[model samples]
Target: MIHQYQLNGYNIVLDVNSGSVHCVDDLAYDIIALYQTTEKQQIINKMLVKYAAVPEINKAEIIEVLDDLAGLKKTEKLFTPDIYQSKAFDFKNRSTMIKALCLHVAHTCNLNCQYCFASQGKYHGERACMSFEVGKQALDFLVANSGEMTNLEVDFFGGEPLMNWNVVKQIVGYGRKIQKEHQKNFRFTLTTNGMLIDDEVIEFANNEMHNVVLSLDGRKKVHDHFRKTFDGSGSYDLVVPKFQKFVKMRGDKNYYVRGTFTHNNTDFTNDILHMADLGFNELSMEPVVCAPDDPYALQEEDLPQLYGQYELLAQEMIKRNKSGKGFTFYHYMIDLEAGPCIYKRISGCGSGTEYLAVTPWGELYPCHQFVGDPKYSMGDVWQGVTNTELQTQFKLCNAYARADCQGCWARLYCSGGCAANAFHATGSIKGTYEYGCKLFLKRIECAIMVKVAEATLDSTATE
Candidate 1:
């Protein structure tokens, strides 16, 4: 069997190179170097019972290895310097590079969903759809900041992006134009309700954009439970069949159907199956956030059920991916943990990378979740990240800066959970992320197990 090494106390991270063990403290090299200086690799199983006891490090072993290599000192080394520089165990690159740009095409939606986070009652603010000029500026920010990346994704999002098709058309048209001019590849995705997904949107999505994130809360009854119009009527009856039509229009490969669920959902399992059967190969399910007058809250037990659903769904998608069936969720939430994490600005998700949301008024914010909110707004596009004399305010607000989160195994990968969610849950951004850091780490572990299992099954089949 191949060597699989894990450190005591820290189970999420694995030191693949030195076959050593150390905590993912700040995802830096210091801990690894410090651990190796103790020669813990020499007595791999030796338990250090006493802290005051002198270390029994073996210098002879080092001399023996050095002597063995002395005869070949003149031989050219095969390894390149770049290989050594990039040897730090990490997923892809370290800098929080922005692979996706979320453009807030519009703020107002055609429908008045009851539980809409950005709805009238929930959100005490208003801004129209981003004009073409603002969209161009957002695109310019990405183009200028995009380093060592040729493929860029532009994700159109809003209360309902389809409500403003003209802006979306102009943005995509301009993005493609600029991409060609700069010799870069530009991809597109959209997040919208199927209520407005007509022929023009379908044509643009299928032929131009990569995916469309349709907001279907679940099956009709469960969906109608929370998501409704301002008239207090369910949107399910309207969106379900249209959802099917939209799915058929673009097919599974091009479009991804996503849904939200709250405690009001009477049948969560059935809803998952409903979307799976509705030809939505890519399905994302998130629990609803409670309101002040909300009667229900998500129970902790729901997580296990969610885990089971993800496992089953991933298995089904794996089979589909192998047999060329039809659709896959693209291994949505797997392969996060199970490796040494490098400390970098960007992690698995783009918290600091190429994702920034610009509102209609040319205000620059971290993501759509912040947008016009002054509390979360990083800076204005007019001012150019200059709200403070420090580095980007978003960087100051980033999840990695908390003292409570330092030395956390999930820090490098999760980059601290969403800063806005942190603020929403607790009074401060750093405050709540501390409480939920372990869960983020746990999610990474769960993803790693799934990826490992998938890899093993594939290897077995090949053998």
Candidate 2:
């Protein structure tokens, strides 16, 4: 389908199926819009009548534009067959092959961040860690269900995964053993708060975990204001040194110093700059996702400032790229040049189909974000997804199912938004969060601008 929108004073046309983007003038935009709903002859006749009074109206040019639009249709760019509808995934016939599992090894955390989504690691339940036996069972379940998939992924997630270091270590060892016997490869990742990172933890993480995500909310004041110890002391001073040490030890590996920005810190460009200034290369700063009523939650009013911050960050990233020291910002790294096709676009992330999250007790969830929420629990390792209906719900949840996403130019890019965020914000898997939609569109626009700037720079250098 053809999606049209105006951004930054430019009229943009997106050919969704063919993945073509065009920047056209107002007349061309109107012509394309009319062409979609009316016949070619009708469009030409209407255009001739509508622009007859204007002396600058070129009938030949209008006809040429019509020819171009018709060519697009012929090539299946403007009006392609509805492959998404024609070949919709039969959820009943979905494979039970699991490719990735996020193991929530710990339901407890060391720091008491005020906006802890997990309710300070207790998840509104009793704080506990996953037993080695439960972890072993989870691995066995993954191996049995993986079916023909050679590479599997296991992410050690929290509370703070480090809090359950022993079990985490045991699970890694067990997974390694399974990998050798089954001729399968396991990719391990760990997400931590960095508060408990000592020499031993660093050594173990460097050797075992393929990637490490360390949480730090930027500057000392902003970080300490929210993330604190049980005694309410700031964790910045405690964690920063440890984080530096860990990063140094885990050299050249996949690691991210991930942070969260709240309503309190909408001017988050400084946070990115601060992290970059601290000699860290890979970084990701995401906005806090929570109920709108929460004081720290990003409200509709914060969007303007947040968008401006993204622009500022984009400019800073451009400057860094020119300065011979470039860092990877997670949001800025959108692969717009080679985005997914229409088939993959409709089915986002394959959450329930190929990926599942395992809780400390061996209960399975669609994702780590839905760990504590029992409503999303598909099954446990022992039962192997008893709730196929829930899995089908997730598998069928896509942009194609949402009316609001039909005409959005950014729909393919976002893939109908996150299901977990949808559940949290609107209590429905198919619901769209307006705040997230806006942020996604703005960021994508900024990414496009970044690419344009780089291209312009290259042209100038060559000249």
Residues 1-463, candidate 1: write the lDDT tens digits: 0112222212223332222222232222222233334553432223222212535423443334334323222232211011222222243233445556777777877677666667632245775778888888877777776776899888888877777788888888888889977777888888887777667766778888787778887677777766677678888888877777777876545666677766566345467667877767667765565453565555565555655555455455555566666354432554333443443422323543346666766676666666556765656555555443222434444434556654444444565567666666776655544324543444444444445545445433212
Point out the worst 10-residue segment of candidate 2 by lDDT: 454-463
Estimated TM-score for each candidate: 0.69, 0.87
Candidate 1, TM-score vs. the true structure? 0.69
Clashing pairs in 2: none
- Candidate 1 C-alpha error for residue 4, in Å: 12
Against the reference, the lDDT scores of all candidates come to 0.57, 0.83
Regions more than 4 Å wrong, model 2: 3-12, 23-73, 77-81, 91-93, 337-342, 455-463
- Candidate whose TM-score is highest: 2
lDDT of 2 by residue, 389-452 (tens): 8988877777666667877777777778888887777778788877888898888777765665
Clashing pairs in 1: 96-346, 96-353, 98-354
Q: After superposition, how far is residue 133 of candidate 1 from its true place, in Å?
A: 2.7
- Which ranges in model 1 have alpha carbons more than 4 Å from their true place? 1-100, 120-122, 145-149, 290-293, 300-353, 388-393, 396-400, 403-409, 434-442, 458-463
